[model samples]
Target: MSVWRRYLVKDVTGRLVDLPSRLFDSADDGTAPLPHFAGRCVELVAAVIVGDRVSHGRVTELAFTKLYFDQLGYVDAAKRERMIRLMLESCADRRCGSHRQDSHRQGDCSRLAHRAGAARDQLSREFGWEPKPDERDAALSRLDPARLRAAHREPAQTLH
Candidate 1:
């Protein structure tokens, strides 16, 4: 069975771009790149929490993660929901610089916040579920990925 999936990407005009499934398929040996599943989750969250100053860096990191997710077959509903909540939480920052350009505080990625909302909505629509409040803060605060090791995934290589 083919496990095809799609996602929302941001266009130059700040519109949601519907990435097609054909983009996920591999032609040479029929194997796409690995989805850095957890890595993606981390980057998306960082983009919001870190604000606009670091948004580009974080998005760059998540881009690879998204590719890996597509290659590994999309995540389950629960995990997807968790990711959405994080996006929502990050976007809730009141000091979004793009929307408040005059603000003195640094790192205000208001544009990314909007994109996060779009992504959260798209994920919610695709999964047919309502977005719930984030209850992962306490747990997330104590989380440390540096402790994780080899069991997470194998190294990448050419499929063909």
Candidate 2:
């Protein structure tokens, strides 16, 4: 039998949601698992904010617990820090979209920004990860919606 334990996060309606067990799988060389877990956490937070799926506060709480307290064996300090950075970037992206020129999407994006910011702050506080001065500015610039849109206008590059 596998030694890994299943993890759950509570939704907005107070229902328990299962997180994939693969997220907790350790690397074969005894290294901590990679940043997929962090990406998954960002996806969950985005679902709650953009898709209106769950309780943002509760989900973030459990996310922090999973990343910091619960899965320390599978995720090391570096991984946890990377996860926190991912959450921060998501927040910055949502916030930037709020300032877009499209008025129709502005209101929705503003609401999403607020929700994402709350989740981001909660995770930062809980995980004790803070972006450096340069990183704070870099995160915003990197996720700027206008820049993202311009980049997507180019032809898609195919991977070999």
Candidate 3:
């Protein structure tokens, strides 16, 4: 197991990202105390931000949660702004349930996408990563082909 993978724990919350226990203080190494990401959790925050796909709600949740969990950006108004912008850029889907849940009266889908894209310029500097051209396509391309392959290709594996 790679050192990084050891600290990686699947979120029971059912979102598709691997969260770091060190950041959340959920690391359970029996040998000794693990370093916590109380104030320097930039990488973990980036990973979560990157993992945000398919659901605008998840991005919104991550954005709000990072205010406390990620020590690097919450204190800066600009950083917080960029995070909001990213969430907005992720809001192109008119059918997204997250838009309906916004208590702020931001139910307009195109407006949401516009708001999210507002922070594109600051993404790299703030989060140490930037979206690629056609970023959604890139996100889709990251899927593991093996996991998506048909499982019952062989006759014995078929129910019939």
Best by TM-score: 2
In model 1, state the lDDT of residue 33.
Answer: 38
lDDT of each: 0.34, 0.41, 0.34
Q: Any runs in candidate 2 off by more than 4 Å, and if so which?
A: 1-100, 129-160
Write down the TM-score for model 3.
Answer: 0.26
Show the lowest summed lDDT stretch of 10 residues, model 2: 42-51
**Model 2: clashing residue pairs?**
12-55
| Tens digits of lDDT, candidate 2, 58-141 | 111112243432243344556567666757655664445424377757766777677777767766555442334333223223
Q: Candidate 3 on 37-123: residue-level lDDT in tens?
A: 334433332222223233311111121123323333223344556667765554444344553466454546556556545544345
Model 1 TM-score, 2 decimals: 0.21
In candidate 1, how many Å is residue 107 off?
20
Winner by lDDT? 2
**TM-scores, one per candidate:** 0.21, 0.28, 0.26
The lDDT of model 2 is 0.41
